[model samples]
Target: MGSTSPPATAKCSSDWFAHKKKNGRISRCPIWGDIGEKQNAVDFEHSFLRAMRASNIEKKDFILEFQLYLTHGSPANDWYIAAAAAASDWDAFAAAFWVKFPAPKVQVRMPMEYEWILTELRLDEAKLLEHHPDTNNYMWKCNEQANWKDFTNTIKAVKKQEIEEGVEHQKLLEKTKAEVAAVQKGLWECIPPMPETPSKALGHSLAGMGFADNSRGRYGRDQRGGYAGRGNYRGRGGGPGQRNSTPLTSEKVATLAWNVALLPHHPNTSEGLQAYWEQLAAWAGRWGREAVINHEKPVLLKPGMSPVASGECFNCGMRGHQGQFCEAMGDQTLGFREREWRVLCGHNLPHSSGHSAQVNNVLDDDFDTWLSGGLGKGEGSTD
Candidate 1:
């Protein structure tokens, strides 16, 4: 009789029945079975409470079912009735439920407003119920008067300050713009006007005479003959009787030198030279009577071997002498002698060849006149 069935076949049938019974445990329970299979005592309690709170179940019905589950280890029939008694709005129960149970899901649903309740009550619910006896009462009061008047006032004050700062910034920008405009206006008024254009007739005349360009007209060989063959000279020019000559002291030399240094680079004639000398004589008189003066020497005029000669006369329409000589020889037809003199002195002229003789004659005569007055008669003459 014991050998009537196979041992392997009987064992497999018993194991299958055991597995089926174990899987059916959650579905057998009424409270958890509605959502899914019941997991354990702790998990069942958490799910039941969440459903109740979300439904805003009345407090009395919640307590009744809560007690039943705590004491009997199972949810009662009509659990939704208990949920309705606990709260008016299911959302409001989220914070209250978290404070009591503090599960992860409940924590997520809890409102941030609960922080005020925690701060005012100063309670850590996890520590112990005894430590946070007044937490519930504090939360109830906070809920009743939840107006943010003080916070709104602080925000308004900050906004007003920002507006005032913006106004001041605009005013500063305007002030800076006005100051810049005034400075620009002053600069415009202070600037000098540009020089006028040269006349076309003057330009054409200069161009025809090969004196139009500065490079062509410039005298290459020191026309004054004063610094010829001299090495590069810096500093001021010197005066008469101040060079390496007899009976000239260094103090007297320096006094004369200072005066001559102020004279123009090229004096057209001997009269211009004599005028400079007179000024130097006055300086020397003052210097000789004053404290020990350091005198500089006069720069010597270098003599060129070229014999001084005159060109064709534009005044007399002749080919040998200048206009001054023409005038001296009783020729009044040369009427542009003064204008020619200005040109010979390096003053810019409108006509070049037309005034060459007249210019040269005026310079030569002026030089002779000045020499006769200064060295010959001791009467300082000016051209």
Candidate 2:
């Protein structure tokens, strides 16, 4: 009201500046330029009130002195202009100023990863609230949940999730255990346990091989060789690990024990054993020089192995060769089992014995060439 005659501008009566003198600080209250880029109208208002309060300026007359707080073009100046026109009391003007440029609120740092938290982690605002963080980093949660102030009013909503996860994990473990048990039960049904006694196990194996129960004593040996005289098959091997030597498989151990038990009664057992070796030697001499030279084991044939690769000969009922390569029989294409299954299934699979199939077999010379390391089918070939 100091310049009412000129209507130039309003200023604080002399009393307003007295607070500075009383506090022994001569600097005026901070000038809010409302300068570049800090467009925070809200913060400007809070700062102005804070200074007024700190200075102990009586709130009733603070409005008249408010222009002292602002510089040109500041939101404070704008509020002061409006306030000067109609504000009857300082408190009334302050209330209006607050409505226009409220206090600076704590804003949420606009969250980026909330979608992943919401969808992938399956967390909602309620779940975030449940974590009950102590004194840091709720700006995101404040933004996500209603808003900072109303949120101050809304966000108990986690111990429950742990209980739910535990339940699910327990259920999965039960299902896995059930599946394993079912497979184990099937295996038990298919392969009964080996016989407990050595003799009984040998007898069972011989029976499976179509030998009579007493025939275990009759096979593999008849005396007359030095081997039968030695009578002890298990010797102390040179290595410590092999000291108590036993055959690798339980079945072989059972068979040897059965034969050993009958050793006293079968003085002629070595004769059969010697004859068996002679026949094996003759077979190797005729058809498998590799066994003589390299001491290679005989071919191992398993069920469902390729018949061609295994050299299974239906004509001679032998596995070391295909019928085409069998010295004992003529060439054939379809193996006996293949032919049988095909006929049983009523399929018109062509027989391998036909001229076309026979033509496919390499000559014996070609097989010999292949064995000498030249490339060929390396299998069943005719003379």
Candidate 3:
């Protein structure tokens, strides 16, 4: 900004100007430090020299008028500069003045978008300047010294950094949107069917029933995935021909079939099963029921007795078993329901998809009033 106050010294006599009027008067600006605006020292010096040429001012004249040019608050009024001014040598005084005040620096401003970022950085301005480009210029102590050159470069780098980070933020926003969309689609699926849109056919990218893949990836004890009920897979999975894990030759099959056909049926219980085995051993039939059971004495386990008694090997159908000598049972195992099937059929039948599911159904669906020992069914039941 230019100075508001006019110079104390009036313009010099116009004899020189009148002489130049024959050639036209020289155009001029106010004396730089007096009436002229103080933008920079360079412009000040130029205007000073031009004013000197226009006035035929002697070498000593500037030193004399220099005091009139300076305001009361000017740096030239300092003790050192004032002492130099007392000397009549204009050159020495100018040199001393120049030393006290270096040339004014150019101004630079940061972009508005990064103004907040710069302000935040200045919260710890020391840290912000730690990675400065002009640290080697130790002569300059602050940004005012570096002004538009090194300082400007540093801000440019910061703007580039902000732009790069903004791109990453955009990418993260897109990822978050996709995740939110997926959650919305899943919540929409939980809503009940509407008459207008009977099925939410957004497509089955997710793993569930009624999806595009028709994939029932989710399965648990709820029978969500089609599976044989408990104690199931007995007839067909991982067994000899079917549920009969021990492979029998045609001769063993023939021998076992005839004898099993003549055997008496037994109720499906611990006591009934034990009695049926004892009864088979004493049948007095020419056909052998089981070679091991027939040859060895039958073990009669009374009710409430320990099942760990020395007797038949459930795993190998052998007596007084030595595990190394006895054959291992194949994959199939007989639980309570499987034993009932065996007792009724005489032999394990191969599972066929065409056959109906029988006794082994959902819990309590197959059992009825026959036992009726549960909550309200029995005599001890609460009314």
On TM-score, the leading prediction is 2
Model 1 per-residue lDDT tens digits across residues 1-383: 23322245432243432332344311222233223433344465566566446445455444433433332333333433455366565454434433434333333536667876678787444332222222321222222222445434544656777989989999999888678656755665676643456554343222223122232233223445332322111101100001122433556544554533443433537665555445444433333323232223222111111011112233332233223223322222222422122222221211234322221211222554556557635465444
Structural similarity to truth (TM-score) of each candidate = 0.13, 0.22, 0.19
Error of 1 at 358 (Å): 41
Residue 131's lDDT within candidate 1 is 25
Q: Score residue 61 of candidate 2 by CA lDDT.
A: 57
- Please report, in order, the local distance difference test score of every candidate based on alpha carbons: 0.36, 0.40, 0.40
Name every residue pair that clashes in candidate 3.
2-37, 204-212
- Misplaced by over 4 Å in model 1 are 1-158, 199-383
- How well is each residue in 271-368 modelled by candidate 3, as lDDT tens digits? 67566545433432322333333212222222221121122223332223222222332322233322332322222222112211132222534334
- How high a TM-score does candidate 3 get? 0.19
Clashing pairs in 2: 221-269, 222-268, 222-269, 222-270, 222-271, 223-268, 223-269, 223-270, 311-321, 333-352
Off by over 4 Å in 2: 1-43, 73-75, 103-383
- Per-structure clash totals for the candidates: 13, 10, 2
lDDT of 2 by residue, 72-155 (tens): 676567767867788898778867866765555776654666765567866555664553222232223343454334565552
